[model samples]
Target: MPKTAIVPPGTGKPLAPYVPGILADGILYVSGTLPLDAEAQVVHHGDAAAQTRHVLETIKGVVETAGGTLDDITFNHIFLKDWADYAAINGVYAEYFPGEKPARYCIQCGLVKPEALVEIASVAHLGTATGA
Candidate 1:
């Protein structure tokens, strides 16, 4: 049950002092992810849908690197700068997770980046089925 830190390609320099994701005890804990591009520049400023998509894509990359998939995601904690963008965010979210949706809690809160409309943190279990 050794712990491992993951920093996806093009993650660039982290805005804050935190690992992008950690694998420990058969679970992957993805830190709060933003819509930063390969160079770490925030993308899709002011657009919740696009930002959400980018966040999920980053998460997908991390999960795959850990030998898991979107289906392995069991929970997600979403933070939004505005609640008005809820519907738009959900629209993109459904496309990424069309299966038995992961347990999630989304709240309207101030994000680290002003232009960012959304940020998300997720947890995925990497059991024997998924080859931990």
Candidate 2:
């Protein structure tokens, strides 16, 4: 059966769709995490690098909550509003993944919300262990 896990402190409002993480068939699918702060407000405005860092950190949190680590990531989908910021984004991304980066596809899209330049979604292999 598919299992869904919601990150703590649910906002009690439907701001964004989908739970933070879902596990099925040994794969954990993490939802796209933006650079939003604790208040759900966008952080690191106007700075692509900082925004990247913020979002990555958030991704790490979700991964851990799902009982996995960044190293377990097998694939990633990156969305960027401006392709020119790829270099800057990569520079910050390297710090998180370090070695053996996951396969990724980056696409330019019109973000649902403004002020967000990048969005990242990941799929991870949580191994055979149950309840990571």
Whole-model Cα lDDT of every candidate shown, in order: 0.87, 0.80
Model 2, total clashes: 0
Model 2 Cα lDDT, one tens digit per residue, 17-67: 677677777788878877777667778888989999988877777677767
Poorest lDDT segment (10 consecutive residues) of candidate 1: 123-132
Candidate 1: tens digits of C-alpha lDDT, residues 1-132: 678886666566788889888888779999999998767788998788999999999999888877889999999999999989999999999999998999999999988878889999999998743332
**Alpha-carbon RMSD of each model:** 1.9, 2.1
Model 2 lowest lDDT segment of ten = 6-15
Residue 11 alpha-carbon offset, candidate 2, angstroms: 7.4
Candidate 2, pairs of clashing residues = none
Model 2, runs deviating above 4 Å: 8-14
Candidate whose TM-score is highest:
1
**In candidate 1, how many Å is residue 68 off?**
0.4
